[model samples]
Target chain A: MKVKSIQCKKCAAPLSLHGGGHRIRSLTCEYCGAIMKVQEDFALLGQFKDQSHPDCPLSLGTQGTIKDVLFTVIGTVSYRSNYGDSWTDLHLYSETHGYAWLSYQLGHFTFTRRVRYLPSRNMKQLSPREILRVNDQPYQFLEAYQTEVIHVAGELTWIAKVGDTSILRDAISPPFMFSQEETENEQEYHLTEYIDPEAIDANFELEYDTHRSFVHPAQPFKAPIRKALSKASLIPMALSVLFMFFLTLLNMGNTVLSERITHSQMTGGLFVQDFTINNANHLVEIQFDNAYGSRFQVKDITLFDDTHEVFTFGKKLKVKSSTISSQQGTAQFKIKKAGKYTLRLRAITTRKWANSDRITPYISLTIKEGVMNNRYLKYLFYISIISFLLFYISRYFFNKKRWE
Target chain B: MPNASHYINCPQCGNQLPLTFQYAKLTVCTHCDSTLFIEDDGVRLAGKQSVLSTIPSLLELGSPFSYHKTSFVPVGKVRYAHTIGYWEEWWVIGNSGKGFWISVDEGDFAVEKPLDLDSRDVASIPSRDDLYLGQTITLWKDQWQVTEIDKGKCEGFQGELPKILKVDDVVPFVHLSGQTGQLITLEYLDTGIEAFQGEWIDPFEIKREG
Candidate 1:
């Protein structure tokens, strides 16, 4: 590459202005370190004989390529916070694309470019929970403050005077950072992104190790890992929901063996019914449709397989209102003979106000038998729950890696 | 306004004035403090009397500095007294022959240039009472705040100013600050309205004329 012919005003050292320095107003001497103001010629502006810049591998005039575009180093400016934290901004210029910056802090690099547009909302509208979205990506607020220019060097498009301050607000979405810097004359928005140094070095065919391993603030997880995790999380949940729907559709139909449709008024006596089981190892469902919302008194409710005493229980239900409902009892067992079985219930039914002469509450009963796989579906549901938890945990960690 | 001339004498006080430009519409007689109006015939009394007094400042006429890529030399100054104290405004002539201003209140300095009405969005001039500190007004597509409000009178004048200034003239003005320390000063005078846009530049960042 050809270099411009120029001379430092102070030390008379040979210097060259690269990357279209036509608008540049200042350049520092590489020898005596004198700040020179450029116009038709050059004039000495200041001196910095003692201050040292940040130690970094790249220096002024380092040329590098990114995404097939070549960028030349032109200048570097340093800014400081009130707490004394400082960072250097390397201004890079492309002959066809104009200017951009690389923020260097402790070996970390963030590629930045000026933003061309902004959201309509103002700064005050940015809430803690709010993530301002641009290009379908949400940007979370990081910090905001006024930073002072502490140091400056090399050729620049505009005059960068030390001690000048600017208002800045920063936000980030993994791999990307958004900033608004307001100088006295103009407000500019910029976007910064984290790039893998290994990729950059590999693309440029450089021998140096630019691979940084430290966790940067806006560094993103590997694309493949995040994409796979997201897919693993979503696909299983969707399949489980669809399977649940299928199980529900199959479980809706039940075969009724016996049901009493006629109203049977209880006269405070015991009632017994002999029912036969047609199949072995099947669920026997006994149901009672109750009305009048009355207190039910039943004693020694029992089921017997030819007096073998299969199952016995007792219960009492207190009546509340006229809006009555049904009751059910289910038992799944092998009857062995698949023959005669008797269900017996001793009960007294009455209303809360006996003197009111409302007719005694009528009771109804139904018996149903079916082959059910409710237990298996329940086990599958629990397994799906575990998978849901696993997916979410992976997602949480993935998002943390991507954004924090 | 008359064309350029070498020299002329004040009609009221017979003070010889070294007039150089045709656009020097209004000037002061240094010997008698009489305001003179330069016209085609000659320098005549501006029909005004001013008992002016000077204020001490760090920057005087002919002080040169570079700002916004333009080299300028301070050519004029106007002093105004407020309720709290006094502030001075200096008009600097640029290499392009255009004019700029530098305001000094206490120790702060602001580099300024005149703004046309088309550069602002506000339709009408706001009343003095309507302007308060912390109020915001948009100009040149950026928001600026009214940081100061003062009712002052012209206390002193010197050199060739963009506009005429007479002692004891009512100069009600407001100072606005942008988010990044830019300044917008609006001066309301009986003759007309004037607006100047500027930014607060640090003295340490400036390199004096060598």
Candidate 2:
């Protein structure tokens, strides 16, 4: 029979009819202790005794104990609007000794239910009273079905009780109507098509029956740090790349500048050479036998004599680089005066580094002129005196505080 | 499918002319007195003299000094200037010889005194009184000696050229020309005496003017 909603006439307290095949001879109100007779059938379903009863009101069930109850939940194949559409799977068996019913309490409502044992699993084949059973006895179904609303956030869950019987069956069948052992003798087939016979006994093993329902959390599930960082997008990465590119460009410019400096100060050679100094024209020429060991271009060539500055030559001096045959190497300069001068030479070989920290040293050389008191020495004397005077005048007032 | 070079004969004057780009019904002939209307493949009438004009001009080249501040003094007596129709002009000159011409615009310039030149007559002067940009001196040959050191009421030439002004922000420039070779541009503010100048901004700047 269907469970109904009831209220006390005096205090207006609500109560639910819960047990299957339950009966009552008389009832008294707890507030007023007044007695009332128990009534049966659908007409008096939700009606209760007055507050004048001596104790709480009770109702009775005319059928035997509720039994063979099944708790089921159906959810949308995808997702849907109904909450109760999700059910539990709890099938029970009962005996004449006591009333048994399956109860599932999810959040608010406790779904108390019982089922009947019909001739077939198909409900359409049996009459109402014949199909519906309580405590191994038959009772007609009360309504289409009872629905108790349970408020839940995401997923629907419940605890199911399937075998609540006063009398114990000698053997119990497996909870589900299918098992791998029962289908062993059949031809090897897909597991989806398998089903087994339903049997019940008091002493038979019963699968653990306590089942809890819970909702699985929905998620884009990221840990706190990772999620926060991802939300910032590619901004940090872009900044890093841009910074690296600028740094690389700056390094390249510096390399170019340093290379130019080295090229201005070095040169090298191998062989006997004749040096000439033209005091009037201020020119010097060095002729030598070319050493063919390497294709060494003169990176820079400078000529210095005693105390004055000769050509501190290089690309800066407008000295064009030339490739000479193995027979000869010639170096020339525009000298201010004729003199025996110390000639310094350097040859820089162009090279690129494969590693970031590779180092390249500047190439250098030194050559001393023979004997100092030559005719060029007199001209140098005058040049030195004039240079001193110019230097003195140029720095005449470099260190003065003005605007004070 | 009409080719651009095809021509038709005029029926009135028996003259042949190519079709003009513009579409029109009647055209006036340039060499004859007649009106011409092209029908099918032939001109039906001859036209009077048609006015002729010269080709229109677009994207004409800019003036000579179109670019500004576009020159680099890479080293001594060597300057590269980016200008009209050229990437850069390289100017090179031996210390004592006349500077070489690297462009059609500017010819050779003289070299006053090469620091490495041998003649004692040549004297050199430091570009600036400051220690910045590595102190460098401008060398003058003995012939061009410092004759006077005037120190009063000195005034620079009133001009907009960077080489003329010595005070107010512009640095002293190395004035180089053919025959003159290399000369220090001493502005009127300099007074040819270093005593009054407190400090120098740059050693010397290389200035190029038309």
Candidate 3:
């Protein structure tokens, strides 16, 4: 049946069913604000003084095709859960089909419809562990909650009054679900399935991006976030690989210009050992291995090449960590002329914090002419690992915050 | 099989009475008030009276509704009431001319067809009082629970009904339900036990109307 013209009996205001259905039973008049019951004559069923509802992207009377079915938005109802979160349900009416609903919560959308089938088992006895097969699809029990209608607006086919409570039981297998709204008198069942916001927005030709929050709880974005982060990390990772390759190219040499390893003991308060670099075209390195009997702090070690100061160390450094105190210090001395380079070292023989009986310990000294002690490679190795770790950790938390 | 264009002359009122229900044992004359019942010997009359009610159901008597993607035109209605208010059972003639009932109780609606009584053993079925909530009662190898058992009286009726019903006729019916929204109404009458199987529905979900 099609609606030609209808009048509100309460105020005699001309009204028309928004969806063009003559089967409209109870609807509130937009002009004088009176609920009219459609019959031979419109009877005043109730007075809708405060008709309020939440704002939604899909407005009333907005026609959109969902699942290949065209539906008109006829009503909107707001429901507040016990957890302080609320959602809006948009009732869609199809004159030749039936009623369907779209629920929006924080930009997440779900389309639902009342479903009926021959249920073989007792549904009330089912728990989460049990599975219910409907139309060859398996749905697992999720949870049950009670919700109350806080507000409503527009025309709804069923009675939509405020403070009307219903116990809703939900079962799901991802986007698809089986739901039942149980009241004192009747138990209404519905099959609900979620719709992607992007698809819905595209179909309705509406912009919902601004209305959507940064993250949707039910949206599957964590995996995609992780994948994007991994792709982004290729920049830093590639930098590290390139940096390591450069270090490998720079530190390529096996030139031992001069070498000497000699052990000598000095009973005096200080000792000095000299090693000469006979050949020096490449870099020259003068190394010393001092092993003492006990743990002791050593004063500054300085080396002089031909009485010209070459290398020095600041601060009292630690010897060997074990009882056999082993310490190593190196100094680089490069001479343009290939000649004997005499190097001198300084040491302290005082047994401070030492646990040994020998006050004097033997020290070994070696001088190389071609080896260069460049510690940039070691530092670069440590910094690369730390940087990669920090970058990966930041990406993890960034995605977690956005998705959670 | 019942014919959608089936018509007969009423013996009591001498008016055209359309037999729309397949298992209809009773038919009412639209022109004259004649409650006639079909019998093996011949069509007899329990009494001649017209049925009337004030229940405003969109799927009222002689209205069209759809079920399972099929169109059905209701030709009879049964009015019943318990303590709360009145509910209705509209007997519809399906596209195949089969008899089915669309029961409207407040916002809760269902379309049901009569079940075979002799198909199941009812010796173990508990009475409506003994069955608690969440309990199951087996009928014809299917399990259902008595959700609400109330005694309702037939206030009025119109059109064609499967069984002959009159005003002030008392009936005790137990509303049995299973997990799939599968509902069964076990009505106890003087004619013994009667079973009806159906699934609950939302009235607004019914798409077409005539």
TM-score winner: 3
lDDT of 1: 0.65
- Candidate 1 recovers a fraction of native contacts equal to 0.00
Query: lDDT at A178 for candidate 3?
Result: 75
Docking class for model 3 is incorrect
In the range A1-404, model 1's lDDT, one tens digit per residue, is 34575888877888877744345677876556678877646688776565456655566788887644577778888888765767888877665345678777655677887654564446445753357865457778766678987677777767776678988877777788777888887777777888676765564454555655455666775656545555665565566567767855764435444544222533345667788777565565555654433455434456788768876654434334335443444444334656778877655544353557566554566555554445555565566566556656765776665444
lDDT of 2 at A394: 33
TM-score of chain A of 2: 0.18
Rank by TM-score (best first):
3, 1, 2
TM-score of each candidate?
0.43, 0.14, 0.49
TM-score of chain B of each: 0.79, 0.20, 0.86
Worst 10 residues of 3 chain A by lDDT: A257-266
Name the runs in model 3 displaced over 4 angstroms.
A1-16, A20-25, A30-33, A37-43, A65-69, A94-98, A106-108, A114-144, A169-180, A188-202, A207-217, A222-226, A231-345, A352-404, B1-140, B144-210
Model 2 C-alpha lDDT per residue in residues A1-404, reported as the tens digit of each score: 24454554444455333322223222222233222333422222122223111110111221212222221221101111123343321222121112222222221111122111121222233332234332243333211222222211100112111121111011111111111111112211000110111111111222333232431111012245433444343444445455555544542211100122233233233211224443424224343332421333443455556766566545542324444423334444455665455544454343432356344333223222221222343344444444444433432322111100
- lDDT measured at residue A32 in model 1 versus the true structure, 0 to 100: 64
lDDT of each: 0.65, 0.27, 0.65
User: By DockQ, is 2 or 3 better?
Assistant: 3
TM-score of 2: 0.14
